[model samples]
Target: MFTPVTIETCITFHGHVCGGISLGYVLANYAMDKLGAQRGDDLYARMECQNCLVDGVQCVTGCTTGKRNLEIIPGGPMALTLVRRDTGKGVRAVISVDMPHGLSKEEAKNHILSLDPAAICTFEEATLELPN
Candidate 1:
C-alpha cells in the first residue's frame, strides 16, 4: 500500500532581507490565523540570514535596532515553511487556503507549471532538524 506523505510549502521572500525575521513572524502569525492553526503550535518555520555582506563589505542589519551580521538594511533574507499535519488531505487544504492569501490561484497555477516537473515531492519523506 502506498502511504500518503505530508506536503510542505516553502515561501522565500527576496528583498533587502533585513527585518526578515520580524516579517516572517508576522507572516507566520497571519498564516496561522488564516489557516486556523492552533496557538503555540508549530504551524510554520522561519529562517533568518545570520551573516551577510553587501558591496563586498560587512555591516549591521535587521529590523531590530542593533548590530547584526551585515550592515545592509534589507540584506537579510527570510524563509517561511508551511507544513501539513496530515499527508494528503492536509497538503491539499493548506495549498487551497494559502494560495489565495499570497498569490492568486491563477498565478500559483502558472508558477507551479513553470517549475521543474521532477521537483515535486513530499515533506514527510524528508527529515528536517532545527539547530539547537
Candidate 2:
C-alpha cells in the first residue's frame, strides 16, 4: 500500500519550493478531491512542460515516468491534465499568472526564494477528455 503524500514532502522532494511546486500540489489535490481518485492508483497526471513543475507532480502525486502515468511533453507552456482511469474524468488547468517580467536575474531569484510560491500562480480550470 502507498502512504499518502503531503505538500511538505513534495517540497522536499522537488528540491526547492517555487510556484511550479505549489501548482503541482494544488493540481494533484484538486483532481483527487474533484474526481474521487487516489493519486497512486487510478489517477494519471499528464503534464506539458519540461521543467520543475513536472518534478513537483512526480513527487506529490505518485505519478512519474516509471509508473507509465506521467508524460512530459517538452517545449510547451506549463499546463497539466489529471485523468482518473476508472471514471474517465479529467481536469485541465493552466497557470493564470503571467510569467515574471522586468526583474533582474537577482530580483527574479529573490522573488522565487522569498515570495509565497502559491500566491504567484492560480489555475484556470475546465473539464477535459481523458485519453484512452
Candidate 3:
C-alpha cells in the first residue's frame, strides 16, 4: 500500500559561503531516496524529506540568499529511521548521512577511533519506530 511520510532536516553552517545549505539539502534528499530505493520502497510514493541549510550571517542579516561549500563525511555509514505516523497506517522514514569536514587520512582515522562504538550503536538503534 502507498503511504505518506514527511522528513525534514535542518543543517547549519558557520562560515561565509554560498549554496552550502542548498547543496546539503540536495545531498540529504538524494541519500534518503537512495536508501528508500535500496529497501524496495518508492520514496516519491511513501516519503517526503526536505533538507535545509542555513548560514550564520544570512540568518542574522535576513538576506535569504547565500552560497557556501558543504563538507560531508565520506564513506561513513548512513542512518535510516522508519516511524509510524498518527494516521496509524502511514509510515515515515528518515535517512541521515553525516558528512564530516575534509580531514587528512590519518586525522580521519584517529577521529573515528576516538568515538565510542557502543554509543554509536545505541544511537543507530534508536532511530527507528515501527508500526504497532
Candidate 4:
C-alpha cells in the first residue's frame, strides 16, 4: 500500500509548516519518480532554497544534513535535487509556476499562515548529476 505524505506530517517535522514545505514533500516524491528511484534505505536530497521548504524535504525524505544524506547550497535559484546514494542517479526539482489566488500580498501571507495548500506549484523536471 502507498500513502501520500500529508501536510500534518510536515507540520510535525517543521514545528511550523507552510505551503512551501508541503510542496517540497510532493516535489520530493515527484523527483524520485523522475529519477527512477525510491526513498529506500539511502538517498541524497540536494536543496537550493533556504526557506521553510527545506524543512519539509528534510522530514519527508529523511535526508537531513545531520544524516549526511542532504547537501544544501545557498544563494541560488530555489530548487531541489535528489540523488540515489548507491547508483548516483539524480533528479532536480524546480517550481515552474506559482498559482495565485488573486489576493493581496498580505492575504497570501495569511493564507500560507493559515495552513492553506491553495498555492499550487507546477514543476518542470530535469535530469541532473550531484557532484561525486
Strongest candidate by lDDT = 2
Which residues of candidate 4, in runs, are more than 4 Å off? 1-4, 99-132
Off by over 4 Å in 1: 1-18, 42-77, 87-132
TM per candidate comes to: 0.26, 0.67, 0.21, 0.69
- Candidates in descending TM-score order: 4, 2, 1, 3
lDDT scores of the candidates, listed in order: 0.27, 0.64, 0.29, 0.63
Q: Candidate 3 lDDT, tens digit per residue, 21-122?
A: 433333333333433322223111121222233222122212122221112223333322222222222222232334336865345434533444332222
User: Which digits, one per residue and each the tens of the lDDT, describe model 4 over residues 54-129?
Assistant: 8877766777888777888887665778777676666677755462368664454455445422233334444345
Residue 85: error of model 3 in Å?
A: 29
Q: lDDT tens string, model 2, 1-132?
A: 677677578778877756556556655565455555665667677787877677767876687889777877887767777776676567665555654568663454455545454454444434444456
Residue 82, candidate 2: Cα error in Å is: 0.9
| Model 3 whole-model lDDT (C-alpha atoms) | 0.29
Model 3 has how many clashing residue pairs? 11
Q: What is the lDDT of residue 15 in candidate 2?
A: 77
TM-score of 4: 0.69
lDDT of 1 by residue, 56-117 (tens): 11111121213222112243343223333332111111111112246554455455444432
